[model samples]
Target: MTVHLPILEAFVKLGNYLTDFCENSYEKPSDTHSKFEMVITQAQHQNGWFTRENILFALKQWGDLLTEEHLTAWLSEYTLKYEESPKTIGIVMAGNIPMVGFHDFLCVLCSGNKVLAKLSSNDKVLLPFLAQYLIKQEPLLAERIEFTEGKLEGFDAVIATGSNNTSRYFEYYFGKKPNIIRKNRNSVAVLAGDETQEELQALGEDIFRYYGLGCRNVSKIYVPSDYDFEPFFTAIFKFSDIINQHKYANNYDYNKAVYLMSNFQIRDNGFLILKEDEGFVSPIAALFYSYYESEEALRKYLTENELQIQCVVSKQKNTDDVPFGETQKPNLNDYADGVDTLEFLLEL
Candidate 1:
């Protein structure tokens, strides 16, 4: 007799397990706890950006999000069907931050499709470990999840994430196959000058988390023409210790020197540099800012350049605007590139 497993329920259990592990791993150590600690160290060694704190933060965020209530509410919008013979989906993941490709991995499995993932070398450690936990919870997943080191073959569809240049290559190669190809995108914030110290402090989280590597990290800001930088700088001072990380410090020194040599007028707060630029993507340790004449003008600018923006962080909680520091803490339904991964997988 075949044993039937409820995949969704397994995930819910995994969520609870992770939450407990994160909260009480040290207090009640076990073999699994030791393994988690080991993997975190390994991840840090593999990618310097994947510090223990950042990895833990990512895990806790997912743990908090994967509860039954959140899962049910998110899945309720879609009509889900498990196929008798599911399609093999190849995913090209990005390595900008830890577990960046997990949502895609989750979507493929949740839609009852097979995932053949090409893990970025920088982030090759965490997901596979989590995959092992999932497979242990629901043995059937052992057949559904795969990690590939070589070129992806025998895949029915593709989902690739990369820089703009690599995206062109992805399109050329996977053009014939049904695919979701994502390119470089960055998030921006709109400052109205009246933001409270607490709000600005939270906004610092949106900027410095993952050392400003992820697409969701706010890389640019729009401020009123007469905006003052004193309060903004003071509020974000809590994150000043980020410069102690050698990798980030090097980038900070290098970028600051380059800016000074270029004779660009930039506002510096010893750790972070803010430059006036029209671009959305900014270098590490440097934030691009532009002066807007008015809120209406800023909205118009954002509307015209929506393609280059992953999210817009502002006090205003409009349909499109993400509130203050919430950009990096996206929900399960907040699809990247505004494309629905679950819907795409279901159609396949």
Candidate 2:
């Protein structure tokens, strides 16, 4: 078998293992259960925001997406012609959510390139564990992946994910190389106020998942002017336990106090705050909302701020918006910032 086939097969096994791992914390004596548990505990200790449930949610999402069928379907869209001499693609991963950069790593390997990964300090453990799992399954892949603690060097191209401010530095430093430098982007939901209680409740997951840290997490919603927040708030009560998390609670207290002191008119449901703001990014524990007079207004604003937005969630039969609550469950093809990583790797 070719090297790529073993890698793909290994990932498929890893996905199956992860699905079983999340469904049941099986204490197989020889398995990596103890190490995985340590990594989860360390992740939460290093970053208060990285809760065990959130990390597992991310893991399950990946497990579902990393199937053979999904990989084949995503790769079918491209003619994955690799460089004669495989290029080194440096990936500066984001620490916002667990395994946020795994897709890029997978894409690099799928495109027959090498990965030079510089992990974020906050999310250092899990990806390495997965990589080790892959290499153990397919020893040939051990040569294709490398981790660097110091500065990234000898890379032909780079894929970096960071805030908008850090992107400037990335561009200045990696300008000469073929690179994908991702910046801040937020997701939004368009609610027509007539959605079913189920749909509205799912929207709550989009907002509350990962404490709204991911770019795919819905940070804001656009609703009709006469939208009644009572139904919306009621539907989201299922996620009320989120505030019990001390980090989330701290943000809620801090932002709520700031809003109250500033005399800003805000709606609260004991745990979450809803404020009227025209911004895409909202503070943790608070979601910004804007009253849309018409679909045309929302379209115009979206066009003007296209780069700042990630995915749009709505029930309308529109291609632009994702179904409610599925923002975080992106397929392999849902490239970040709409940039196709596989295509870039092929070109390189």
Candidate 3:
């Protein structure tokens, strides 16, 4: 189980590239300001916000997290056995957020696999740049990494991320191969009365980061019927500035208008609204409906519909109490949708 020197070197280079790209490429607020202006202009032409500033921020954050020690440790732990020879894995990426497919890319590469990554149209820059950097660091990996805008075939296995609608297509197309098909999933947050102010503030990051467009964003809030909404709203109110941002304001006004015209009763406190519903995912900026009369009822509901939920953010002192704001930026150990990706890769 000796670690391969070449692979380790490539991992180090990848980390350096990420660090330089984040710090050097877009270092100043002016840089971000200009990018935001361009994004707004592009957004006006189309119906989507490119979110370039947020992307830069996330990349910088990820670069900081992917330290040399961390990368080396993860590589050593995950790639020890397959260092000499690795699996060839093809990855179909998702464009839900900035480099949303990066974790999958890291898992495959760290598991000692040749990575053939198909970049999402919404995110076409970062991965290719990373591949080129890796090639320069370790020429041996040049053939191991590739970027494409089209379909990829003839890999030992595949990992594809898509919506619930496209999952069926992914299954039919790559079903014959060893594959992991990821469908749409929304995260949830359960608020116990005991959360500290600091924890709640960090939880706001989970709720508002990337304007709630990410799958790991808290789309549903499960609170006790008697629980006061004041603290929660108070803690999250800092994100009110996001409402002033045109992109988020548009979504809020659009949804609010729909509610008004459709005559759907929505309880609004100006910042956010509370509605009654039975699902995990919420409409953008609009929290979905559900209240628990008792902890027993909440437990019953969770047990009954466990399959529909991804991770639960809570301050409880048990497995049920998922930490606040840790949903989207999962640790290396946090497997996606509760599936152990490393284990699956190893088994294949």
TM match of model 2 to true structure = 0.96
Query: For each candidate, C-alpha RMSD in Å?
Result: 2.2, 1.7, 3.8
lDDT of 3 by residue, 1-348 (tens): 344566666766666655676666546545433554454345334334446566665666666657667666555565355445667898999876777788888777667778888877766665665566567777877767777677887688999998898899999999999989988777778777677778888788888888887777888888777777778778877877877768678778888888889888887766566666786777777888577778777877777776677777787665755688667666666666778777788788
Q: Identify the runs in model 3 with alpha carbons over 4 angstroms from their true place.
A: 20-50, 75-79, 82-86, 269-271, 318-320
The alpha-carbon deviation from the true structure for residue 298 of candidate 2, after best TM-score superposition, in angstroms, is 1.4
Best by TM-score: 1
Clash pairs (backbone) in predicted model 1: none
**Model 1 per-residue lDDT tens digits across residues 234-339:** 9999999999999999999999999999999999999999999999999999999999987887888888988899998988854678887787789999999899
**TM-score of each model, in listed order:** 0.97, 0.96, 0.86
Candidate order by TM-score, decreasing, is 1, 2, 3
Q: What's the lDDT of the predicted structure labeled candidate 1? A: 0.90
* 185: Cα error in model 2, Å: 0.4
Measured on C-alpha atoms, candidate 2 has an lDDT of 0.89
Cα deviation of 78, candidate 3, in Å: 4.5
**Tens-digit lDDT track for model 2 on 1-348?**
123566778889899878878877755533577788888898889888898999999999988987888877777787765444788999999999998999999999988899999999989989999899999898977888999999999999999999999999999999999999999999998888899989999999899899999999999899998989999988999999998999899999999999999999999999999999999999999999999899888888898898999998999774778999899899898999999888888887
